[model samples]
Target chain A: MSPQSPNTKSLVEVRELTKTFNGLTAVDHISFDIYEGEILGLLGPNGAGKTTTIHMLLDIVSPSSGNVLFGGKNLRHHREEILRQINFASSHIAMPFSLTVEENLEIFGRLYEVPHRKTRIEQVLEELEMTSLRSKLARTLSSGQMTRLSLAKAFLTQPRLLLLDEPTASLDPDIADKTRTLVREYQRRFACTILYTSHNMKEMEHMSDRIIFLNRGKIVATGTAQEITAKFGQRDLEDVFLTVARNG
Target chain B: MNGNRIHALILRHLYLYKRSLPRLMEIFYWPLLDLVVWGFITVYLGQFESGLPHIAAFFIGALILWDILFRAQQGITISFLEEIWSRNLMNLFASPLKPGEFLAATIIISFCKVVAVLIVSVFVAWAFYSFNLFVLGVSLIPFILNLIIMGWSIGILTTAIIMRYGQEAEVMAWGMVFIFQPVSCVFYPVSVLPGFLQTVAHVIPAAHVFEGMRAVITNDGFPLPELMWASGLNALYLLASILWFHHIYDVVKAKGILVRVGE
Candidate 1:
């Protein structure tokens, strides 16, 4: 029931994107299209270049050779404009420790030039159930609360492109489930494109509309969870992931 | 490029000082302590060094101005290091905050910090040794500006090095200034150094600044030519430092080191 039309255009176009560090390649000539309003899960095992691909999309890491186009605009020439429509969140990084949660959110909101910031911040806080912790220092927050805050910051801008790296990693099951639901709800309400990465196979099956399986900086498979599992003659996506990760 | 975004960047650092008691204490306390310690040393030395006139003002004023330069440089470097410490550099760079805006905000924040440290040092010098840095009057403005510019140049270079080499180069944040100190001729005159070192010191804007300071304190009139030389040299250094930072920034991006900085 997405608002996107059957003829919806791609939001992100990656053409032979590759990244090499020193003598080693992290992402090797990967090409894909993320359609508007689709959840594209970049799935892979450790050192599969999943994170490196995400970094390229975010322009945090440069490609050794290739191009990424957002809305038909070249990322090299239109980075700030393209990035304005993109937002990213990760549990691996934390906000400034001394600033309160509200302060942190407010600062990020201002940086993004989010309109109606006060109302937007409050709405995001309420949506994430972080209203009570708004005044608490970011450093003092529990891990679960910090994850919630990270999600809140991502949702604050109502971005057209959302990049998330292991958004639910290390979360308790209850909170992880809730986080997934929140992400789904945010996507539903905003119809934003999501490029999500996670080690949780179940989460991938549940969340991603299409999955790209990468191994050793190359894409080994691309399909829906059921499609991938069926192609590999496996009962589930986890088995398919194990097959690809182990053999490739 | 964006004013509001730059303000947000500054606000992040300001909030750190606001909430942290130790951070606030460190700002005013260290300068005060340095002034007190140096003031007593000057007093003790003044009784023995009768050959040098206005030796007390020269030493005390030199200490305060030197601290100004150090604090200005540390303000930017330490604030950037804080981002690394808090694992916030990636977040800031990823946002709409352009690198130039980030540098501008850091410079403004550095000015605020140096002013705080300068005020405390000046107050302590006046209270303890009756050293009035303002006696040099309007010429003092150029001296302060020249030293701050030089400090910022060094700071920009230090940050670029840290960005390129990661946390391993963090020691440069504190150590780099003292490397310039000897060449800067902060505590002594350029002539006191050997001829070769004096040649090296002349290239440093701070050498001219200290020379100007000593000239003013000894009733030699405002060192206009020295101020002009310091200003011209510092302008070049500031431009070079900024270019160095941008160069390193490009390299850091290509190398994919930004995300791994704090770790």
Candidate 2:
């Protein structure tokens, strides 16, 4: 059985969650809901606060005035408990440099308190086709390889809610496709609810149940792949993103 | 952070040190410098006093304890700066790990380093200057609180500063260690400081730590009140530092300092 199958009910509900800097509001009171067994992709232009919103939802950035609910509780109140049930992967971050991939996974798995951590680590390594990279230091991994390791780490927590911030950002198209495939496979097999942000429109259109188009930190539009493309009078989701960025 | 996670991070750092070159610098070279440079000075002064009864033994312990506490202070936030340099601070912060985990792991790791430095410095003192912490080990518990607080306070304050200014402010983390080493009564009594500076010297917490250590070793027993005062001062520093750190953390995080720093 997959880790997420049991929690296929509505698992995350972000409400009017806003974050600001100085006088400028960054994530301006955006509200969204996420259910289990589905992938929701967040698409936005640079500086649109897509990453900021994700950071707040993951408890990385504190909200200015609103609540982010996770597993039916306010995230700030049950922060650790909520965190224990979620994991995140991003192309933009890296783990410890001195530790090998295996060691990094060991530390995170131990932190995750995964039962039979060694077996799980091996499982992830096998699944990701990364067993050869296990003993390699994280700093030494190619960007593509690091992305894979990050997905492995995200899978470690066996989280009900998995947040991916441009997990394939900066990857070649082939690797990006493979990365997306791996993430989708993880979701399909584990039934993990993925809250994702991606610049790659095709990837988002392919994977998301609903793609949220965010502009100036608010969800300007959200719908199925065709629903969004038709509303924006665009051929694809990428055009919708451009319309939101330029006109929203 | 949960207990198991904290334990896991602490063990990871400890294990990392056992496996890394920088750990060697912390565990071996840096403390060796403390012992050798200061050991020579004490040895040179030895001829003029030449083991002035048990008083000389107390002074030897005073020096060793001084090095340990200062290094304990040094260990606080410098590593956090390294995290910024390597851009790993955000990675850890963004993880499931909480702020408290970073603080606790830092303290545990710094304490371990301090213990290692103390052991080596004591060996050097006992070998060359007849100062034996072995005889004074019973009084170590009170001393432990003082150094641990100093280390944690320095760690928090440094983390705050690093969060604001990145790696450039890292030296400020260790600034007081070498800067205050001279007047902290590490080498001599505060009485030796020219009148006004003596009063100023007494205010820095390590002055009290050294004085308390000297009292324990020479006075033949632990001085509970004085040690408690030292610990209290360290606690106050730790509290203030943590508050300041959290404030800065909120500000920078809201402003996306973590992202800018990474860029």
Candidate 3:
């Protein structure tokens, strides 16, 4: 699918967002807009502020001197209201281990206050191909299964904006490819906007509608995958990432 | 706060308790052991005919009441610790669940657990030792309420510390309330303490609660003043603890440590 037009409404507007720890800035003055129904890829090296920025967008991390407006509403003032329409998934995050997969989804479904919760949960499980594992405890699932469960939770809410942090990091190649396709299909079906991050260059090019590359807490480049590759005078995003990491 | 969100959090913990035998056993095992041991001690003490009248009531009642505070605090702290241990804190905060709603759920869970502990302790005390906790009459309501609030205050404070400092501060989850036990006079009178320590005990809500509990047992008349002092102190401490938690929450967010808490 092609990227959303510039004229498309902005679902999230991050203005001069910055975060400092002690004297070191983890996310320096940075800003971007995630257009509605577009998958915005946040690409960066190991020390980049991609996760920190995602945390700020989720309001789990407070910016040093910036604001995030979701659907034209200030996140600080309307955190609960804004968050209700958003969901996040990360390989580094997890559900309650002792709870079964279905129970975990049930809790999140209720947390998001989705209408017809039981039916929604069943549908989400089936969509994620986790129907057979619904009764299995979270701790007992393999890493790939855990990843799918996390994705199931993200899709369970049908969130207006989904923030995914290296969500396929733990999945095998086949499962990862399927997950990418699933995400694309979900976004297409529901017009759900996503802010996705990953170290997989080919996957980034395949999944992101527009890519924002960050280095040392600053955005070094932002454009479509081909545009970014051409702008950096590199063969692909992998080369561009190397150039940014080594030369910047 | 939305009731659905609060119920979701409560349900999350309830599922954990429902599935794990160890978790369910924890709620009854420790309290029952404490009751059995203390019941024997009280019985042994009764054989001596000491000047302390109703020695069984004094010891057994104090043990049961003390469990109320411990279990109440654990209900909140351990529930939160479970999230941390499971690496699920980020998922929870990232959801629409507000901090106030989260605390409210823990408070309700604490109440339920406290009731469970109370039933087991009260019944076991009556069955084995013929000690009826209801002898304190209606005053039992305020006593339990005050202890529960105090437990919540300490639990919230511990949770804030753990949230900010991560696993390094987790020791507070188990140890923070016990620090109050020395000053709380859970078994002895506050008069046994040094002057300065006595002054310190006066500020603690649990201290007044235990003192009042003893008064009620000894028929020294109703402990209206002690109850009022405890309620007033609990009001102040609970407010202060909640404010402290909010402040720490903001600081953690600013420091960008919320995402690193479980790690």
RMSD, every candidate, angstroms:
1.5, 3.7, 1.3
Better of 2 and 3 by TM-score: 3
Compose the digit string of candidate 3's lDDT tens values, residues B53-161: 8798889999999999998998988888898999988888888888889889999998899999999999999999999999878877898899999999999989999
Candidate 2, residues B62-132, lDDT tens digits: the string is 66666667666666675565566555665566666777777777777778778888778777777766676
**Model 3: CA > 4 A from native:** A1-6
Model 1: per-residue lDDT, tens digit, B176-255?
A: 99999998999889999999999999899999999998888777898999998999999999999999998988888899
Order of the predicted models by DockQ, top scorer first: 3, 1, 2
i-RMS values of the candidates, in order?
1.0, 2.2, 0.8
**Fnat of every candidate, listed in order:** 0.70, 0.45, 0.97
What is the TM-score of each predicted model, taking all chains together? 0.98, 0.89, 0.98
Model 3 scores a TM of 0.98
- 1 or 2: which has the higher lDDT? 1
Q: Which window of 10 residues has the lowest lDDT sum in candidate 2 chain A?
A: A1-10
Highest DockQ against the true fold, candidate? 3
> Considering DockQ, which of the candidate structures 1 and 3 is the better prediction for this target?
3
